[model samples]
Target chain A: MSRWEPDARGRLERAALELYLERGFERTSVAEIAERAGLTERTFFRHYTDKREVLFAGSSALQELLVDTVARAPGPATPMEAVAAALQAAAAVLQERREHARRRHAVITANAELQERELIKLAALAAGLADALRQRGVDDASASLAAEAGIAVFKVAFRRWTEQAGEKDLSEFIGESFAGLKAVTAGT
Target chain B: MSRWEPDARGRLERAALELYLERGFERTSVAEIAERAGLTERTFFRHYTDKREVLFAGSSALQELLVDTVARAPGPATPMEAVAAALQAAAAVLQERREHARRRHAVITANAELQERELIKLAALAAGLADALRQRGVDDASASLAAEAGIAVFKVAFRRWTEQAGEKDLSEFIGESFAGLKAVTAGT
Candidate 1:
């Protein structure tokens, strides 16, 4: 069986996170990560280019969902709504795996280097999102602003979602944050 | 007659930018940068921690100014106004050194690694600004949103300011961007 399967990627991420949590990020090599996952380093490399990448491997999927959703948003969907829809799509994909997401979040927040890489990824994601909006003829400044606003909402809602054990569904929290951002920005 | 004078820092930075533009960041070394400035490498180390830092040595000063402005803002200013005041203060400082600012911008934009470092510093600056607003009794969500919004305006204004060549003032452009942002976020 080839290692280039979606489940294979998920398994590698799970194994890496478990070891990273137990032994920490700096000390855990890819070899150790693969061994713990009952897979080879080659398999691990095929899935993730580096240990730092495991935390971000899903970003590509998220980006694709965001861009595709924004592109197909209904008429009268503003940039923010288009992005909000994308966030809802992502919530559907992520919210079901709550335990895994929480565990990964804990490990990421504890490490500064990982946090920096994560920030960079988010910045890139924001830029990509803005580009998607611009492609829909949203003009440069507005496209950028709306996309950034949406990312800010995503950040806040994601934090809230992860922090609350059972307070609200991810999609619901996202909706609230979207309305909140629009409300906040509305007040001039 | 020593180089440890008040204006010595300016002299060093000038030399560094000139060397970087002439021979590039990698081709230039600390000793060369110092020597070009008519100072010893020891003197350069006294001012800046590293060679790459010469490009970004303004960050801490900007952070301090923004934080102090936010903390001391008049009580009735809305969250956005408080954040905007911090950005206006930064515009004052940055516009004062427009030539050097433009030079550094050109150099940093040309290099990938430097761009990454620049993004990291910008992220930290935004975080520091948000924390400062939060300290001023603003709620976390509002504070972060204001700070992020301020940064968005700054990015747009700074890009416009840096590219202006025909005797344009950065401070004026900053003012315009602030008004534009407020207008877009207004009445909706």
Candidate 2:
């Protein structure tokens, strides 16, 4: 918890989630969260815009990771394949944070306001992915379809992974969920 | 315009959308919406809880229609088939409202807060569809996957339908979108 530590942001996030879970998101204050982390409110503000940001700070990075992967995918890969590959690659960013992700998910799911924010974040991710696809010369409708479907696959897979207690790889679950999506769409 | 008219809700919705589009959602009040509709504030309150609800009043009915269609689909139909059928069936509810739907879509798309609510409604519809599938004996994961994929298709198809100015039926667009989803997932 020293000021020189490299995990200041991570510590703040952990503390914020703990306080939010214990006191309810509406009841938790930034001061209390910072105090719990052995840091000052200024430090909390330095890391996050507000308490809600602690739960959603990864969204921008996740979107960037997805778009970058899609843009760099092999030429032969189809739109969905590119998206799936992007999802697989993005897993690395989340792999080591399984516990943190699960706790964050729980906090978000338990609160209606937080859930709305989560959906908005997911929608933004889909939009960003679609934009990335269009940049790769994919048509708008097809780009949107692939991106939205990829997000749908991610939501289901992430829920399963969190519930499984890190027993399975996030990428493996994403692959399986993508296969499940294919199966459902294939009508068999 | 008469007090005895049966379309109080319709009148209020049209007026509300007009006001929202002109002055923006935040600036539009229920009193202004009601006055624009030639009705009193009580009538507006009677039909919608707030200004935001005016844009989303159809969500519950839309969810019911989807769940019912899925529940009543032929026993031999696959989960995706059931969802596709539900989307087709649900289209009937929206088919005649093309202009209204387009305007509503415009209003929601122009505002971030409304877009969030739209996403929340779609998520709720997905959850309802998954629940209906489970009631028909499908497993949780498969039900959720189909439901979420169906929602993604719906979102894409709806946007296309609105943008196309009703040149084709909503159901047709939905079918084509579902096919596109299948093609994307199939990696072809």
**Considering every candidate listed, which one attains the maximal lDDT?**
2
In candidate 2 chain A, what residue range of length 10 has the lowest lDDT sum?
A: A1-10
Q: What is the overall TM-score of model 2 with all chains considered together?
A: 0.95
lDDT of 2 by residue, B66-142 (tens): 99999999999999989988998888889888788888998988998788888899999999999999998888788
User: How accurate locally is residue A81 in candidate 2, as Cα lDDT from 0 to 100?
Assistant: 84
lDDT of 1 by residue, B19-103 (tens): 9899888899999998988888988888899989888888888899999998888988777777778888898888788888899
Residue A186 C-alpha lDDT in model 2: 88
Candidate 1 residues lying further than 4 Å off, grouped into runs, are: A1-6, B1-6, B165-168, B179-188
Candidate 2 backbone clash number = 0
Residue-level lDDT of model 2, residues A1-188, one tens digit each, is 45575688988888888987787888999999888888889888888898888888888888889999999998888898889888888887788887788888888888999998888888999999999989989888889999998999999989998889448899898988988888888884
Clashing pairs in 1: none
Quantify all predictions' global Cα lDDT against the true fold: 0.79, 0.87
- Chain B of candidate 1 achieves a TM-score of 0.90
